[model samples]
Target: MIRHATTADFEFIFELYMHPAINPWLLYEPMDAVHFQPIFQELLERKVLYVFEVAEIPVGMCKLVPEEHRSAHVLYVGGIGIHPSFAGNGYGVQLMEAIKLFADAEGYRRLELSVAAINEKAMHVYEKAGFLKEGILRKYTYQKAEDRYLDEVMMSCLL
Candidate 1:
């Protein structure tokens, strides 16, 4: 099930965001839980964070940020990750399907997201989920730790 994330989800969200296998592709730089709290709180406040749960356990997370006015039909999907422990269980597909339904139900006609060009696995996953590669945004994201700017592949799915 995909549902709004709440304060109770702090640990799961934190663990997933900071996981060594996942962090580099995610939004935040690695940080201690103490430092992540405020950012987590802000996510809660924004009401865009969601959790993909199995029964009662959250195993994945994503952000569904809707655009306003003329672009209101678009939902920018971001910060998506499935726990490494559950990586091969088809959870990623399930999460993408649920997000599609969720966006459709919310009146979003377009779903947009960007992946690092270096992340072929994720690009494949998004492609399998029906998102088409729109173009490449050169040096779209900066990896401060690596002292390099990575290209981002833009993708979108029309629902």
Candidate 2:
């Protein structure tokens, strides 16, 4: 099942976000309950966060932000993660489909997301989801803890 995420799902979401398989790709350090409480609350109020479950077990999450307040008519998809145990099980594709359905129903004309250059698995998933590589932003993100830079690949799909 794919559905809007509620506050109760935060703990599970945090666990998935912190899973070892996800660390290298995620932008932020693993979050704790306290760290996610406020953000989850805000997402719930804004109707932007989504959770995916299979057999009643939470498996992944995706967050989308509209660009009305920004420079484009695009919707930004951020922070998509599947638990390590659920990776490669097609949950990522299902999450992408759900996002597409929501975008189409909301009259959105484009969807955009950024992926780290080294995250090949996620890049492949995005491509399979119909998103095309737009360009790469050199040293787009800095991992302060690691004292290194990461290139970001920009991708978008026209609906």
Most TM-score-accurate candidate = 1
- Checking candidate 1 for backbone clashes, the offending pairs are none
- Candidate 1 lowest-lDDT run of ten: 140-149
Relative to the true structure, candidate 1 has a C-alpha RMSD (angstroms) of 0.7
Work out candidate 2's RMSD over C-alphas: 2.1
TM-score of 2: 0.88
Per-residue accuracy of model 2 over 1-159 as CA lDDT, tens digit each: 568888788787777666767755765665677886776688789988878777877888888888875545689998799887777788887778778988888788899999999888898999888999999999988877578899999999889
Clashing pairs in 2: none
TM-score of each: 0.98, 0.88
| lDDT of all predictions | 0.93, 0.82
> Which regions of candidate 2 are displaced past 4 Å?
69-72
Model 1 alpha-carbon miss at residue 104, Å:
0.4
lDDT of 1 at 4: 95
